[model samples]
Target: MSASKIAIGCMHLLAKLPLPLLRGLGKVVGRVLFVVAGQRRRIALRNFELCFPDVPEVQRKAWAKESFEVFCQTFLDRSWLWFGSEELVRSRVKLVGATHELKGDTPTIVFAPHFYSMDAGGLALPLNTEREFTSIFATNPDPDLDRWFMNGRQRFGNVKMLNRADGVKPIIQCLRKGGLLYLLPDMDYGKNDSVFVPFFAVQDTATIPSLSRFARLGKAKVVALYNRMTPEGYVAELTPAWENFPTDDHVADTARMNRELQAAIMTMVPQYYWVHKRFKTRPDGEPSLYSGK
Candidate 1:
């Protein structure tokens, strides 16, 4: 069998085990990864140092290591999320607030940050409600893996997946038709339609201004959503929709999105995706943060 097939087989096997067992195994695997993945560990440590400079180095290192373990748990949990029984999945997830109120005529923007269990939040909303869903997914380079991942995401309901390369027409149309747009806008995607914004006191972070546009085009309400793991299972929490969003200025709205994202990330410190180079793309003539120069 091919390597990818073998990996898929292992994921299926992991899916068969209980969540607690998977989490335990994930911790051991995560420790090994933290040691072996030198670059990722460095990047994660650096992110912590940049974001929380007030904290001591020892605490930052501890948070980085714990973040690795939580990330691995989420990675291992995806197989079960994809292939496990819906009843089983439903039993494992708890909706903390009114996430099922998709009855309104206005389109909704579900703003999800990069928490470890963010996928759970994505799955929870669609599974619990009958709202037609739409989301933008980054395509994987490997064809087989890409197909598998897409299938997993769309398994629950009528979810329209847009390729990242595809422009905004389809998404805008979907929103105009009162579809829920599940957006994860925390990552740095270079400087195409993005503007430099402040994230966790880091200046010049590239952030997408699409949220403001979508809210305006669709007349949507922006709802903050996040999922975090607890001893019982996962909690998909939703805040009350924002009142005065998508004002005349797109830049201010983009900054507001980042500020809300920062607050959400604070609720689950270690579960955030710190391995990403959030500060890699510096402005004008600034130096690279992760180049280790």
Candidate 2:
């Protein structure tokens, strides 16, 4: 079966558990991964070492480990928070703007970082407000566990899943209808399609197509939305940017937009910088943050 089918099924079953139970389960999974999974540990460590070169090696390593642990804990907590107590999820999040919606033939774009609990980020938006949008999602890592999780996302009133195979039509149609659409332009889908952009002054092969394609095709308002972490609740901010999006030169424009994306994401939550491979695919002839004594 297709990925959308599996994700849709697995997550549904997981959600059936009590919220507390899910939280516990997630904690257990995180702890196990931290202790047993060395590859991701290595990735996190390497990424951090590069991102924060000025910090002492020891300090960077320590923060990366702690960040990984936190990442795992948040992963579990988010699922529990989203499925069990919708209010708690909403409580932690504060929405900034509302002028754009999936109302008619005008599409609105929402950019969220894979920084926080992406699952929680998904729910927080639609659940917090009575607004609606068709959010795009990458295929699940585990095909066997797809169904239930995908369904959980769909539980929110607004999100319409845009699978990798057939995202174009639905996305455009949704935007044309004045609906909101979400996508993450961080991961590299293909080098041929990507542009090397400066993320923290380090060039990364980032996703430029999503924004470029949307900007090229749709006349919708392109808004940069980011969720900032705070002591109390998340500060979700919205800022409107160039719409035609400098479609003149695909590579340069894409790179510029990516740099802008990095700036916006950093502003959202400075702590998120502790964990991602934000500068993974750097430009040739440039020394990588991953390199050090």
Candidate 3:
């Protein structure tokens, strides 16, 4: 069998295990990653250095370690999310806020940050609610993995996953039709449709202007969604929609998004995805953040 197939088969078996057992295994996997995943560990540490400089080194190290464990648990949980029964998955998820009561009339954009279990929250929405959710899915390099992701994300059959390269036309149209868009706006997608914004007090952070633009064009209401790992299970919370969003100033709106993201990250310091090179694309003539070994 191909590597992807073997992975899928393993995950299928893993999915049958109890949540606590899977999480215990994930903790072991995380400890190994903390020592061996050198580059990613460095990046996570760098992120903490930049974002939480006030935090003590020992505390930051502990946070980074926990972050790895949470990330691994979320990673492993995908199998249960993708291949498990609807009742099994739904039982493991607890809805914390007004996501249960949201009406599908107004165009809704659920702004998801880079939490490890963000996909769990996305999966829950379409499975529980009757609304159709649409989101942009970036194609994976591995063909098999890409197919798996596409199939898993749309398993509930109420979602429309568009390729990221397909541009924003489809997303805007979907939102205009009053569908839910699970928009993840925290990545550094370069300078084309993005602008440098202050993320966690870092001025060189690259942020896309699409979130604000989509809200205006589709007449969408923006709400924050957080999926967190608790002792019982994953808790997915949806804040009420923001007021006076997507004003005439796009940059200000993007800044507002980042500010909210910072606040949200504060609530659950670990579990936010920190392995990415967020500050890689520096401004004109600026030195790189991850330069030294």
> How high a TM-score does candidate 2 get?
0.73
The candidate 2 region of ten consecutive residues with least summed lDDT is 266-275
lDDT of 2: 0.60
Cα error, candidate 1, residue 21 (Å): 0.8
lDDT of 3 by residue, 1-293 (tens): 79998998899999999989999999999989999999999999998898878889999899999999998988999989898998887888777787644574689888988899887887878876778789888889889889888888888848898888898789989988888989998888886778898998587688987889989999899998988888666888889888899898999999999999888888898989988888887788988888873
Q: Say which candidate scores most in lDDT.
A: 3
lDDT of 1: 0.85
TM-scores for every candidate against the unseen true structure? 0.97, 0.73, 0.97
Candidate 3 wrong stretches, greater than 4 Å: none
- Give residue 169's lDDT in candidate 2 (0 to 100): 78
Task: Rank all candidate structures by their lDDT, best first, as comma-separated numbers.
Answer: 3, 1, 2
Error of 2 at 68 (Å): 1.1
Candidate 1, residues 91-149: lDDT per residue as tens digits?
Answer: 99777776545666578998888888988887888887787888899889887788878
Clash count in backbone of candidate 1: 0
- In model 2, how many backbone clashes occur? 24
